[model samples]
Target: MAPLSIQAPDDGTVLGQLPTDDAASIDAKVKAAARAMAGWVDAGPMRRAEVLLQIAADTKAALPELAEKLSKEQGKTRKEALMELDRYIGPFIQYAGLATAVGGRHHQLGGGVAGHVERGPVGVTAAIVPWNFPASLFGSKLAPALAAGCGFLIKPAETTPLITLRLAEIAQVHLPEGLLDVVIGGPDVGELLVEHPGVARVAFTGSTAVGRRIAARAGQGLKRVSLELGGCDPFVLLAGADTGAAARALMGTRFYNAGQVCVAPKRLIVQDAVADEMIDLLTTRINRVVPGPSLAPESTMGPLHTERGRAVLEEQIADAVDAGAELVGGGRPDGERTGRGWFVRPALLLDPPQGARVRTEETFGPVLSVVRVRDEDEAIAVANETPYGLGASVWSADRQRAWDVARRIPAGYTWINALGRVYDELPFGGVRASGMGREHGVEALESYLEDRTFIYPAASH
Candidate 1:
């Protein structure tokens, strides 16, 4: 069979071909992963940690090459790709240090009995990572899986599999056979991996709709599943907030990865008292963002990853505009950006209809919708209106007020006066339809581990 072709969003050029996998390939990988688990467990936590650290070292050594690959395949600038690739190593190191910390609990039972609870890996795991931020998301899964002694098959998104293929080559050289395997295909291959009888766990980072299907499939098999899914996050600008800083922060999140981030702020909720100022500041900053090819150093934003993505974004923009949303800066592409690349200008929408698709849906494009509210309570109401509770950001001069408002918002993670960011030390995930389970920190370790208890006589203990 002919392999699938990967087209670069920046230039519409063919990057490479990713060979398709079938049910048999997935079955073989699952069996191999199951076979590899015993050896990984025998190596113990410390040895696994050592190998994880070595992987981190290898990743860092190949940063430039990997970053270039990431840019070409994922349509991100080299600078941004470099930062993301560097972040990929952090989880490995963090999980390595945390391996020894994941200890079991001992409990005293009455009547001369004692109990011990242990945490251990689920064998033959599978990770389905999205195209956006592939390296970072994969690291979030791979690092903790290694520390917990789980063997997993990584299925990178069809649009961006080159970097992961290269990473797999490095893994084969440094880690045990079958410990890390990369299978390339679309959703069918992912479904095969999820429903495989031999696979015990599934970790996915993608759209909520797709995640629901994976979760249901995994649930049918009674398999452990972790989903880090979609978000239509809110950016709240309270009264007395610094308009300039808030605009900068908002644009920063919206323009990063060309606003393709699942946790990027989609709704801009501002106090009616300062709505005009916020709009003015946002339009000025957004206009300055140059939308060009991802490889260009001067371009602040890049094209959408696929033509379909651009089409969906354009449809949303048109709906919002027809519904009386004022296009303050950008909404359509023009001039040089109107060429072959799938580029959309950074758009600032003022007073868009609450029910507008751009306001309600996760546009996944460089579009920011502003909603003016009466007070803090209204701002909080608007923030939590979305079914997605992935992330939110609050900007206020009073730190205490920001914290208080952030606390009221129903989200898995919230930021005060800053945009969304993920770190290895902090737990990241969402509530509501955003996702189930968590990633990063000890929470991620828990997702891949299962608990077992042993009871014995006190004397035996």
Candidate 2:
């Protein structure tokens, strides 16, 4: 068979291909997973942590090959690509460390109810991971589900399915084959896993449109679903804030992953007092960060994940420019950019008309849109305008005031002193169109588990 190439609408090639496993095979995998999980669930905290330790060690040993292949295949810069490895490794270690300490709590009994409730694993979980942050997102889903005594079937994104599949291969030794399995393909395979009755729970990360579809399918099966969908997060700067700090924070949020991140700061709102300085500094930063082939040492930024990603972002930028959004850095297509892989210059555009498509749309690219506001009130209103509430960043010299304003925003996670960044130990999720449910942190394990009521009323009662 020929090598798979992931092209968007233009090149017309499929990236990853998953084998068709019949119902019998699916059943076999599920059965194997259940059996393995039974033993794993009973392995006790120390033994389970030991198993995770081996996996982490194995991951480190495999890092060079794993990171390089994942980075090259998906067009992420080596640094950004390697970060996934760290993300995966850290969570496994953290979860393993906390496993012995995790459990349900006792509640005060009232009325006729005598005993508090307990939570238990719901059985096999089917996890579907997206292309962006492939390994990290996969780890985010799989680690918790597994830690909670659940088995899983992985459906990795087409652009970067290899690493996920590879993770499963290693699991075959330590994970007992179906205890953790990977079906290496995209949406077609996803439909099978989602609609399959045997798969009890589903975790997905991707666009909101697809999330809705997954929700619909999962709903039919009454399968538990956890979604981390698209986010057009806003980063606000107040009049009293340091313009320099805001610019740096925006640089980190807006350009990380070449701006393909779901919670990446898509909007930059600055109070008018320092808006001009803020925009100028932002332009300087966007211009300085170079984008190119994945392997380039000097390349801090990398190509878009796929041709389609690059094309969509380009169109959005074009629309914004035509719609009168001032382009501070991008809009010129360089030969170097067009000649090699899917690459676009980082864009810094000022806010255009109200409800402009660029302003409203999630441009998951190396682009940042700037909006000017008269005061903190307008800043909050503008920030909260988006239907997404995945996360937001607030910057001000008055830390207390920034925290107050941040609380008013609709996003689930808000950073007063930093950009829209995440640590694996914290709860992460969105409020509205950004999707429902949380991933990572202690709550992540809880999301995969179901609470049950146990009654032991007194005989007299």
Top candidate when judged by TM-score against the true structure:
1
Q: What are the per-residue Cα lDDT tens digits for candidate 2 across 326-388?
A: 887775346553455677778887876666776777889888888899999998888888788
Q: Number of clashing pairs, model 2?
A: 0
Taking every candidate in turn, the Cα RMSD to the unseen true structure, in Å, is 1.6, 3.1
How many angstroms is residue 451 displaced in model 2 relative to the true structure, after the best TM-score fit?
A: 3.3
Residue 140 displacement in candidate 1 (angstroms):
0.6
Please, what are the lDDT tens digits per residue for candidate 1 over residues 167-280? 878766867788789988999889999999999989999999999999999999999888999888999999999888887788778778888999889989999999988888
Error of 2 at 172 (Å): 3.4
Top-lDDT structure, candidate number: 1
TM-score of each: 0.96, 0.91
Candidate 2 residue-wise lDDT at 14:
51
Candidate 2: pairs in clash: none
Q: Alpha carbon lDDT of residue 363, candidate 2?
A: 83
The 0-to-1 C-alpha lDDT of every candidate, in the order given, reads 0.86, 0.78
